[model samples]
Target: MKATRQLHDLGQSLWLDNITRSLLDDGTLARYIAEDSITGLTSNPSIFDAAIGGGDAYDAGIHAKTLAGLSGEALFTELALEDLRRAADLFRPVFDATGQVDGWVSMEVSPLLAADSAGSIAAARHIHHQGRRDNLFVKIPGTPEGVPAIEEAIFLGIPINVTLLFSCAQYQAVAEAYLRGIERRLAAGLDPRVGSVASLFISRWDVAANPQLPDALRNQLGIAVGQQTYRAYRELLASKRWHKLAAAGARPQRLLWASTGVKDPSAPDTLYVSALAAPDTIDTIPEKTLHAFADHGQLHGVLADDGGDADAVLAQIAAAGVDLDALALKLQRDGAAAFVKSWQQLLQRIADKASALEKESQLP
Candidate 1:
C-alpha cells in the first residue's frame, strides 16, 4: 500500500495545500485523489498568485470575468470559486463516505481583512455564499481580530479553516472560539456539528528559529512545537467540555499541520510528515512534499499524547535564549503580512492577464 494510504488508515487526513486551473484540467488532482489518497485541498493567495502569475492558464478566464465587469477582489474571488468548486466536486465522494467529516477544500478570505473582524466576517459570508460548495472551508486567520470572526462564522453554520495559528496558546484561543460558536449554535437550536480545523504551521518554526539555535538543534523546533500542540489537542479531545459539545452533536475542531514542506534541504524531504504523524489530525502538505512522502515517507511512530519530550526540547531551546511566546506572535504577524503581499500580487496578476487578453482580442 502507498504510504499515503497508511497515513489515512492511521486516521489522519492528507490534504493537498495547493490548487490551480491546470491541476484541475489535467486530471492531476483527480489522480492524486485516486492514487495517493489526497482526500481534500487547501488554497491561499500565495498559491493563486503562483498559479496565475506563473502562467497563462487563467488569462482567458480573467479576460471573460473582466468583460463581465469583475475586477480586483471580485475577479479574483470568481476565479478562486471556480477552482474550489471543481476541487470540492472531486472530493464530494469522500465527503459522503466520511459523512462530511473529511473530503474538504479550503479557500482563504481576503488577507486585507486579517485585522478587521467585521470585514473578515462579511467577506467570509460573501465567499461561502458565492462558492456554493458545502464542502468548501473558508479560511480565516486566527489573529485577535480573526478569532471572533471564526466564532461568528461558525455560529452561522459556516465551515471554517482557522489559519495562522502558531503556538499551543494560539490554538487554544481559536479552539475556544470554535467552542463558543458551537455553544451559540446550540443556544439557537441549531446543529452544532459544523466542521472546523485549526491550522498550526510546522516547518516555519525551523525556518525562523533554527538560525538562533545550536547546529545540533537544527530542524527540531517545529516538531517540538507540533508535539506541544498535539498534547493540547489530545487533552481537548478528552475534556469534559468537548464531551458536552459532542453530546449536542458538535464535532471536534480538527488540528491541522500547515507548512509541512521542509525548509531545510539537509533535513529529510519527509521530515515533518513523518515526525508529526498522528491520528485524528490533518496534514495539509505541499505538492512536492506530498509526492516525496508517498514515495519514501515512513511513520516512525505516532506522537505521544502526553507530548513526550517536547517539554524538555522546548525548555532546552528556551534556555538557549529562544523566546517561544514572542516568536509565535512574530510568526503569526509575518504570516499575515506574507498573505497580504501575495493577495496584492495575485490581484495585479489578474489585472495584467485581463488587460493582455483584451489587447490580444483587439488585434484585428
Candidate 2:
C-alpha cells in the first residue's frame, strides 16, 4: 500500500494543498483522491496566483469575465470560485461517505483584509454564500485581528479554515474562537456542527530558523512546533468545554498542518509529512510534497499525543537564542503580507491577460 493510504488509515487526513484548472481538468486531483488517499484540498492567493499566472489554462475564463466587465479582485474571485466549486463537487463523495468529516476544499478571503476584521467577515460570508457548497471552507488567518473574524464567521455557520498560525498558543486561541462560535450557535438554536480547521504552519518554522540554528538543529524547528501544537490539540479535544460543544452537535475544529513542503534541499522531502501524522488532524501538502510522499514517504509512527520531545527541542532552540513567541507573531504577519503581495500580483496578471484577450476578441 502507498504511504499516503497508510497515513490516512492511521487517521490523519491528506489534503492536496493546491488546485488549478489544469490539475482539475487533467485528472491529477481526482487520481490523487482515488489512489493516494487524498481526501481534501486547500487554496490560497499564492496557489491561485501561481495557477492562473503560470499558464494559459484560465485565459478563456479571464476573457469571458473581462468581456462581462469584471476585472481586478472581483474578476479574480470569480475565476477562483469556478475552480473551487468544481473541486468541491469532486470531493463531495468523500464528504458524504465520511459524514462530513473529510473531503473539504478551502478558499481564503482576500489577504488585503487581514487587518480588517469586518471586511474579512463580510468577504468570508460573500464567498461562502457565493460558492454555496457545504464542503467549502472560507480560510481566515489566525492573526489577532483574524481571530474575531473567525469567530464571527463560524457563529454565522460558515465553515472556517483558520490559516497562517505558527504556534501552539496561536492554535489554542483559534480553537477557542471556534468553540465560542459553536456555543453561540447553540445558544441561538442553530446547529452546532459547523466545521472548522485551525491550520498551523509547519515547514516555515524551520525555514525561518534555519539560518539562526546550528547544523545540529537544522530542519527540526517545524516538526517541534507541530509536536507542541499537537499536544495542545489533544488537550483541547479532551477538555470539558469541547465536550459540551461536541455533545451539542458540534464537530471538533481539527488541526491542519500547512506549509508542509520542505524548503531545504538537504532535508528529506517527506520530513514533515512522515513525522506529523496524528489522528483527527489534517495535513495540507503542496503538490511537490504530495507527489514526493506518494513516491517515497513512509508512515513510520504517529505523533505522540503528549508532544514527546517537543519541549526539549523547543528549549534547545530558545537556548540557541530563538524566541519562539516573537517569531510566531512575525511569521503570521509576514505570511499575511506575502499572501497580499501574491494576490496583488495575481490581480495584475489577470488584468493584463484580460486586456490582451479583449484586444484579440475585438480583432475580429
Candidate 3:
C-alpha cells in the first residue's frame, strides 16, 4: 500500500497545499483524491500567484473577468472560486462519506486585511457565501487582530481555516476563539456544528531558527513545536469545555499542521510528514512533499499525547539563544506580510495578462 493510504488509514488527513487550473483541468487533483488519498486542498495568495502567473492556464478566465469589469482582488476572488468550487465537487464524495470532517477546500481572505478584523470578517463571509460549497473554509490568520475576526466569522456560521499560527499558544488562542464562536451560536439557538481548523505552521519554525542553531538542533524546531501543539490539541479535545461543546453537536476545531514541506534540502523530504502523524489532525503539504512522502515516506508512530520531549527540546532551543515566543510572533507577522506581497503581485499579474489580452483583441 502507498504510504499516503497508510497515513489516511491511521486517521491523519492528507490535504494538498496547492490548487491550480491545470491540476483541475488535467484531472491531477481528482487523481490525488482517487489514488493518493488526498481528501482536501488549501490555497493562499502565494499558491494562486504561482498558479495564475506561472502559466497560461488562467489567462482566459482573467481576460473574461477583466472584460466583466472585475479587476484586482475582485477579479482574483472570482477566478479562485472557480477553481475551488470544482475541487470541492471533486472531493464531495469524501466530504459526504466522512460527514464533512474531511474533503475541505480552503480559500483565504485578502491578506491585506490581516490587521483589519472587520474587513477580514466581511471578506470571509463574502467568500464563504460565494464559494457555495458546504466543505469550503475561508482562511483567516490567527494573529491577534485576526482572532476576533475568526470568532465573529465562526459565530456567523462561516467555516474558517485559521492560518499563520506558529506556536502552541497561538493554536490555543485560535481554538478558544472557535469555541467562543460556537458557544455564541448555541446561545443564539443556532447550530453549533461550525467546522473550523487551527493551522499551526511547522517547517517555517526551523526555517527561521535553523540558521541560529547548531547541526544537532537544525531542522528540529518545527517538529518539536508541532509535538507541543499536538499535545495541547489532545488536551483541549479532552477538556470539559470541548466535551460540552461536542456533546452539544459542535465539531472539534481540528488542529492542522501547515508548512509541512521541508525547507532545508539536507533534511529528509518526509521529515514533517512522518514525524507528525497523529489521528484527527490534518497535515496540508506541498505537491512535491506529498509525492515524496507517497513514494518513500515512513510513519514511525503518532505524536505523543503528552508532547513527549517537546518541552525539553524547546528549552534546549531557547538556551541556544532562540526566544520561542518572540520568534512565533515574528513568524506570524512575516507570514502575513509575505502573503500581502504575494496578493499584490497576483493582482499585478492579472492586470498584465489582461492588458496583453486586450491588445490582442484590438489587433484586427
Candidate 4:
C-alpha cells in the first residue's frame, strides 16, 4: 500500500498543506484527494503568496478584480476566496461522508491581526461568510490575544483552525478556548458540534532549537514536543470535563500537527509524518512531503498515546540547556512575523502583476 494510505489506515488524517489556482485548474489537488488519501487541505498567507506570485494562474481573476476597482487586501481576498471555494467544493463529499470530521480546507485571517483579538474575530466572521462553505475553516494564530478571538469565533459558530502553536502549553490554551466556545454553545442552546482544530507546528520547533542543541539532539525536539502534546491531547479527551462536554453533544476539538515538512535537508524528508502518527489527529503536509511519503516514506509505528519517551527526549534536550517554553514563544512570534512579511510581499507582487498585465493589454 502507498504510505499515504497506510497512514490514513493507521488513523492519522493526511491533509495537503497547499492550495493554488494552478492546482485547482490542473486537477492536481483533486488527483491527490482521489488517489493519495489526502482527505483535506489547508492554506495560509505564505502558501497563497507563493501560488499567486509564482505564476500567471491568478492573473485573469486579479485583472477582473482590478477592473472592478478592488486592489490591495480586498483584491487579494477575492482571489483567495475563489481558490478556497473551489478546493472546499472538491472536499465536500469527504466532509459529508465523515459527517464533518475529515475533509476541511483552511484559509487564514490576515496575519496582521495575529494579536488583535477583536480584529481577528471580525475578520474571521467576514472570511467565513465570504467563503460560504460548510467545510471551510478560518485559521487564527494561537497567540495570547488570539485565544479569546478563537473562543469568540467558535462560540459564534465560525469553525477555526488555531495555528502557530509551538508547544504543549500553547496547545492547551487553544484547547481551552475551544472548550469554552463549545461550553458557551451548550449554554446558549446551540449545537455544540461546531468544528475546530488546534494546530501545533512541529518542524519549526526543531528549527528553532537546532542552533541551541548538540549534534545528537538535532532534528529531535519537534517530535518530542509533538509527542508530549499528543499525550496531553489524549488525556484531555478522556478527562471528566471533556466527557461532560461530550455528553452535551460537543465534539472534541482535534489536535493537528502543522509544519510537518522536514526543513533540514540532511534529515529524512518524511521525518515528521512518520514519527507523529496518531489516531484522531490531523497532519497537514506540504505537497512535496505528501508525494515523498507516497513514493518511499515508511510509516514508523504510530506515536504512543502515553507520549512514549517524550519526557526523556525533552529532558535530554533540557540537560543540554535548551528552554523548551521560551523556544516555543519565540517560534510562535517568529512564525507570525514571517507570515506578515509574506503577506506584504504577496500584495506587492499581485499589484505588480496587475500593472504588467494592463500594460500588455494596452499594446494594440
* Candidate 1 backbone collisions, by pair: none
Give all candidates' CA lDDT scores: 0.94, 0.91, 0.93, 0.92
- List candidate 1 stretches off by more than 4 Å: none
Clashes of each: 0, 0, 0, 0
Q: Once model 3 is optimally superposed onto the true structure by TM-score, how far is the C-alpha of residue 89 displaced, in angstroms?
A: 0.2
Model 4 bad stretches (over 4 Å): none
lDDT of 1 by residue, 7-121 (tens): 9999999999999999999999999999999999999999999998878888888888999999999999999899999999999999999989999999999999999999999
**Predictions ranked by lDDT, top down?**
1, 3, 4, 2
**Model 2 stretches with alpha carbons more than 4 Å out:** none
TM-score of 2: 0.99
Clashing pairs in 3: none
Which of 2 and 3 is the better model by lDDT?
3
Residue lDDT tens for model 4, 1-364: 8989888888889999988888998889989988999999999988988898788888999888988999999999889989889988999999999889989999889999998999999999999989899999999999999999999999999999999999999999999999999899899999999999989899987887898888899999999999999999999998999999998878879999999999999899999998988889999999899989999999768888899999999999999989877888899999999999999999999999899988987898
Writing each residue's lDDT as its tens digit, candidate 3 over 242-279 gives 89999999998989999999889988999999999999
